[model samples]
Target: MSQGKSLEHLKIVLTDIELATENFAEKYCIGSGGYGKVYKAQLEHFDSSNWSSKEGVNKYDLPKRRSTVAIKHIFNPEGKEGFITEIETLSSCKHDNIISLLGFCDEGPDHMILIYELASRGSLENYFESDDKMTYLTWVQRIKICLDIAHGLKYIHTNTDQDKQKIIHRDIKSANILLGDNWEAKIADFGLSKIHPADQEASTLNTHTIAGTNVYLDPEYKKYGRLNKKSDIYSFGVVLFEILTGRLAYDRIYTKVNKKGIAPIARHHFENGTLIEIIDHKIKEEAYGHVFALSKGPNKDSLDIFSEIAYRCLVETQAQRPTIDDVIHKLKKALQAQEKSQKENFKMSLEDIKSATQNFSDDNIVGRGSFGNVYKGVASHANGHTIIAAKRLDRRLFGHGETEYFRELDIPLKYKHENVIRLVGYCDDEIEKIILHEFASRGRLDGYLSDASLTWVMRLKICIDIASGLNFLHATDVNQEVVIHRDIKSSNILLFDDWKAKIAGFGLSLVCPVNKDIDYVIDDAAGTIGYSDPLYSKTHFLTKESDIFSLGAVLFDILCGKQSSIKLDDEHVFLPFLAKNRYQVGKLDELVFEGIKEQVDLQSFVTYARIAYQCLHHKRERRPKAGEVVIQLKRALEFKVS
Candidate 1:
């Protein structure tokens, strides 16, 4: 193909650019700097495959779809390098966290422009600069934004898609990062980027030039000129501290005192254990703001992990800095830790609980478990009036004793996730103990197992949700103890109006703080009869695998569209036994629920069945972890019909 035919979709003429920007009017220019003015306009977006080639691809054949685009108009001779570098760099890179380069205009030396998808919220630098914008960003959102940048950087560093070019963005700063309408982060500005041979190692690059914002520049790259991916990592570490401190790299305070910026100051504070002193007051509010409201803040563990990694990234030696991959992993772990403890957990008055549930009336009872009865009630909250489930502990009944009641209440308060039930303040006053939970409008997951309306995809999603909850439960805390929900069952899984599932009933859970190396605890056999692990029951030992066994039984119940056990010919036949026998005989399809049998894809069925069967493995050591179950169930859901 000739030059005219090469990526014609990405070749916007100078006249079209001029017309869109109203001949480069002043008002249309959203920003201008050392590079050039950036103008926002509604321009035609040319789809890669869309064309009227019969018309020979003229200006008249431009695609009809209009979109908001940011056109970077470069006229300065000094800005030409960045314009060319950005064009080459963005064209080869493709990722969700990277800004999209849509079209470009290079008619002559004086007329050059590059168009990009408009980031509505503009560059991330704006957030930290304005107190009003900073207020909108919570600590949780900040962590996510950092994770997004780390993911994009990883893509650039690894180049696993066979691009055959090791691209490095030397200018890694908040100003170069753009934020979308929903605060989705995208890396931008590749003006000073370099393309090295893909086969070369990270430290192979030896350059005499030092470029990038001064405060965010790496000391190793500046002095020794050892430019590589680690240089980018150091700069990113500076940006990370900037986010944590809510201060710009070039803040007057830093420029006035340290000259090298917050990097050295952050390192000193982190080493001396006074890092929290420099933390942004606004974020400190979010981190410790657990007094009221459903909107919660960051967990201490998450902040510790995040701050430690950020501090590590800014180490003086290039070798001490972590790779982009390590940064991504640590960021994900921090997000999970924060999300687990991010919720409104408080205490409620007995009078308010009584008012919500009509003095614990029998008519108010919506669910009855071995522990007590759950009553649906309406309560006033800071946001507005909300419906809740007030689980009233019946002291008269031989159910979960005081110890178990406290344990059940503590779990939801401390560990919060979408898949795990949210606690809404508890009531404990002189034998009147009750736990409030977010009400499940659609009732229990067991009720809809056989319903044809509950499609296979929905069932698969519910399975994933419950498994995720179980996985979250198994995370070892400070005590190095794992939580084993010994009473996992279909009935224990509550389904919301939207068919979302959450694990409930933690009264029988065991927070076993055994030796770190031990996986099981020697305890009295305990759990629901049909769903209990046979190994635990026989040997008087409980393990996380016991919960896995129970989860397997629940999976089979959902598959077979019935309870854990069925009475056949005057004998109780367990679903696990029937499933195993049928599975071994190569007839597991016979066990699929009739309502969803036709809807289930063969691959999906096989994947789901294989994992569920693995969970039912008689040998405790053979059982798959809850995380593996989550992964397989998601894969099964993916294969389901769209």
Candidate 2:
């Protein structure tokens, strides 16, 4: 390691250290451990070429003092070897998460001290015991801290071109990790760490001693005296569970019953599907607070993915555990999910919304929704004036406990897509309940159904836009939950300038599993009477296919230039029934929208009618998925321009 070249410039005189630490006084010490007592002080460190007195402190002309630093005074023989090992380990390593070594004292027989960059926030162990710190550690912050530690561990585990040997930290725990002023974590106390030989092929080394914290020691390392890289991984896994449950591994809840600590208890809870029972209570409390509030707790999907990776690390078999790289990958996905839940958007003041809508005047009234009145307004922000549609729900009708209104508000906080209407902001101040969206210039799609100027080409494009948005809600490629928009009809679809259609009015959206297409949510049938699927009314099961049934009703309305149901002889008749009867009798064209049927290409009409027909199939199994519907609709559009 070229010890002479490295350690020569780092040597500091004992008297200068005494001045900084007050001669190892008790008041200067910040903390103490098995190694020694650590002190924090403002130490004087002159630039090499600035003052050439060959001494750090000059009585006649003092050098410029550096920032505050920590100094560890090694007092006993137990700490002597550790003092040398720390210098060897930290000198070769350089990373944001790993603490930096500033200087050392080795001249006198009584003093053996090492100085490091001070971490003001202290160790992670204090968070569990301190109330203010504990409250500050949100689920989002916890995930980020875990990522920082994992990245630092990965850097040491990786074999670099300059230094092929990997460094293994034998002791890893909350106490050994220090948090900086910005809440960034830095790993400390590398005295017990060991460097794996660069030339050796075998990862494990036969050691007579297994040294580490009692709770964090690797089971395999203790049983067989085999020291390997996976040993560090096992220890880090305990720290992961510690961050999740907000309990120290050495705490009596885990250590008193089983010295192995949180590994067994956490792993068992994860397997039994009761991991929520062990989650920090603070997180659960915040998750159920006012739903429309800006601050959102960790999402369910995010928690599931995080606990899954942490559980795999506790597997009894060493080979079954995930590698550091794999752990980092899963951790990234977990953080992404958490960020999606607490998305960065606006929290508009009530005054801002009132100003935009002119105090909810009659002139700005745009339309009506199930639980609210839509008002068109112009909101002022940093960019410019943005036209917005603010849907203000009547508190009396919602009763303050209805879940549907909150669910619609939750969408803006968790998900965003181009085909879906963008949520501008929301205001839930007192009785004023509002959800804002980008104003669609052309109003609702139903308002334009009978207008002949809405050409056949534009109609096909609108159909594709709706299908694409619905497909996004039900996409299964990622680990997100499926969104089965319970209400699908022409009134809920809004058109913007250039005929861009966006799916809106998600007050009745139901979230389900993507793989379980027919795995329904058992809720009372609640949708527009004419557009609702028949199966949902009978069985009270709202599923993805039920949404498809409603889509079919909308398609037929587009073709016939009318709503899904109309009056005949003073009684209502459904379009699906009338259209299916005509199709079977080879008379489907008899109901085409007047003046537009002649402009539509025959092949395009044939493609659209057939796909729309399959969507209304009596058997839900025969109905195509949202993805299939998109593909067929695109095929229909291609023939129109050909």
Candidate 3:
């Protein structure tokens, strides 16, 4: 074999490989990102005979499996270290909750490709912005996503082989968390990850690199450029806040005159019981639990658990914060306790309820939420005439936590309330867990407002009823627990045949902290779209004021019969004008709900409108409490209605 003969043979092989690569790239390309292009590919299963006794490598197989893999081909002509590092880190890590790396390809100096199991559902970030994606993941599915991420982080921090180097995922934003076909979360993007030497136990690793999303990055890490496991903790805190509140970590800023407040401001408000103010409107409605009676007022136990866990995990000083293992332990224990309590509190079976509701006929459905479908049914214990609302948890949907639901509802059911919806009981067997509540026959206030048959007086009466119930929830003593509705939206305000309103849903709700976080709450966001408080959405702050803002939005929605955010239909080009005016301005009444001009008294309506406006005030300090809203509404009712 002469040198020229060897060269000739190599050239022939290279030509064939190049042709195969080109075909793969062209046929399978799906999407492109910063590092490379992703393609959904189908490769033939490699047999020993195929590799050893092949006349030539076969490109196609006789039979194909109904499976696909995502191929990320990195086109780095210069052979970049950063690109190589990302691929290497991801390839080395192996966790059930992290996307699996099937293989890698070093086709040429200019091209490096990594193969991973395809995520049919795509990134979690898609769900927030794309209407299609939002429709796909329901509230229950979102909670599972959060749990998956937590499990993945716990594995990275503690469950790995002790002899091996510990892993730290530097980037843990929503965009980096991918969803599989079943909506299971898979933490992706390990480009900035580091392998901590097994022996070293420093809070800050002396890494000469700084990497993470701008808003999600921990303040200490940003200031000192120090890398550690706690950095991932801080990032996860922001992710949790985002999930609970359904808002970006830093969409809006809260400042005092000239001083710039820190990002994740919800952390500051966590201890102060004001963290609820920062939750996303969508999450507020969805995660918003039912109101329960306590010695002082209404209470939301589930949200209290969420806020405590999230706050501890996101403590400003890494030394004080719980490790991922600690966080998981606490959450698992709390969840288990809740599940056990729910099992003990209930007596009736799903079959009995199904039979009572005539096999869950469509006519029986009385209410609905982001996670579960609701049905109206009768119970045998309360004589045949007593009607109860059965909320059936939809397991198929993505976005909410069923475990949290059971945990939050048990205690509330044991204690009855006059103004709050009475939880008669709940049923959790194998297929589903459903809550049975005393039915509010008139349905939600949202429907009342939407129905033209309801006059201005009816709407006003509904408004007063909501304020009174909220007032009961907020008014408390020094020794009594303070109840925060957490979610105060039009839909949650249910009405009876006589139009008397009762506040429902206390699962995502929480009891107020005696000593609340002054700046922010670190829990995952939970609420509805259009009605969420902007302050709570950005910072995960769950203040009573936050509820006031949401309540105000609901009031505004009812009065206007339109969305709160004013839109200029004719001026489709208000970007320049809006930019100049700080995106504020444009008369509230004129811009929104233009249809309500002659239908309602403008004077009486204006007073309620003003109350709603004050609730939505951006500053947490400026917004009135729920009690205050009730008082003011009472005053308005006396003046306008009388």
Candidate 4:
């Protein structure tokens, strides 16, 4: 193809590129590699409509639209060949898991720029780097990301059409996997990709120069300069180890042990049944043994299957490894097992729920909400007379119909986090809809906030518990959907015998649209008055941040030992406002509940207060994510323990 023909579709000019990048300013540089530098720039975007009338259209005309883009500037003469190769490779490839190449510029012999759709979160390597402070990827996220990369590779290896040729991505490392705004993984950096002939039976290439990252390079390819699709699988196996262990492919610790790389170390652990020993500490602490504990699916069994696949991919010979299709088939079966394992075994009949609640006697009632009343009961079944809390929905309420009741039951039943209320069973019949849960002996968190007997240590623990639950809900690992607790407050937090806080009341919850990378919006803001986010109430735009704002109110309630609905006067001064005022004036200690004031460490209290204040930021973007809040609360708990 001629340069003019390629330029026709790209329609980018040198002036627009220079203006967007500020004449290649250093400040615009986001990353650099052996080839050249990558710059982030805001450029004018043209739609099909803008170029529809070709009679009046100019190639350089501004479209009056803007979008963020990444620009790669190639400095090496050899790099120019790679840049052109990437354009030729990506132009014909279109997949959701593959990064899109928007356009390219070839100006003389020294300057070549490739434009790609910006991946806001950058490369996957950034998250695993030693100095990275971002929250660790949850187990479900790691699995999904691996599946996504596999799908992309499957597409590359399979013949999409007779016209499209097969290609091998030589560099399939974490650094080449970019994350978009919704955290979707996209395979990127095709500079080192090799195209195979249409008639090549084995799809193997022989070259004198061995290419790709050292730690992830295929042993066969590295030794004999033999390149094939399995080479990509080998690199992918190394990445799986990185994801599982949260360590580099080639770490100093492994080097010290003479293991040199992760593959050997992981194989040794897997063979000895000590794989769990080398698993990421966070996963072990929060997700081990309880495969269904973190999300609705994807447990230890699924992980074992994944590990076996990775192990097979790292075999010494190329023919011994499974093909991409075989890997996909095995992964799908593993995911199916994960989802099947998450199926709830307790499907009690209406008669059973009645037997448990003693025919809804007033004496058995433990609590009440706008839509329902909770009853304390002993459910007799396989587990045998387990103490339970049965929530009976009142049909008279506006939204307490069969659909709403099931929605409420579905949210709690899908989750398995320790801090989340456990759903025992549910009953949906003509007479009523009831959901049963594990009973909290100590009752709601608000009941104990004002108790003079509660210690500061206990209070800190409650905060951590609440944060953990919120973090789990906000996480996208649950069936690829994020749950937003539209109603979050102290009254909804139930405490067990040991004062472990469990979040309940999902009647007002919202789940992000399936497979979407956007937040769910509601017409009306539904939550307790003092705890509802003011911005959400005014704009009617609901998001996970709204839950964070509500949590901020809970934190304030914990500190001041005041009810969220309590007003300073008839004028209705909210609790968050008063707490913020005190916090900003350096008099936050004045707001600490009198009972725990003396017991609270000054530094710990300050840290807690600061995090809560940030959560209350009027701008949703300014508020800390639930994961960040969890980190800060854990740190505050440590200070208290010290």
Q: Could you tell me how far off, in angstroms, the CA of residue 69 lies in candidate 3 after the best superposition?
A: 1.3
Worst 10 residues of 1 by lDDT: 287-296
lDDT of 3: 0.61
Tens-digit per-residue lDDT, 482-591, candidate 1? 68888899888998988889998888777765336535556677788888999899987877899999999999998888888788689989888889889989999998
| Per-model root-mean-square deviation over C-alphas | 12.4, 22.8, 23.6, 12.0
Q: Say which prediction, candidate 3 or candidate 4, comes out ahead on TM-score.
A: 4
The sequence of per-residue lDDT tens digits that candidate 3 reaches over residues 575-613 is: 212221331463554533444456556567566666667
Looking at model 1, the pairs that clash are none
Candidate 1 scores a C-alpha RMSD against the true structure in Å of 12.4
Give the Å shift of residue 92 in candidate 4.
25
Index of the highest-lDDT prediction: 1
- Predictions in order: lDDT: 0.81, 0.78, 0.61, 0.78
Per-candidate total of colliding backbone pairs: 0, 0, 74, 0
Candidate 4's C-alpha runs over 4 A off are 1-224, 232-344, 397-400, 476-479, 569-572
Error of 1 at 166 (Å): 24
lDDT of 3 at 70: 71
Q: What TM-score should be assigned to candidate 3?
A: 0.47
> Sorted on lDDT, highest at the top, how do the candidates line up?
1, 4, 2, 3
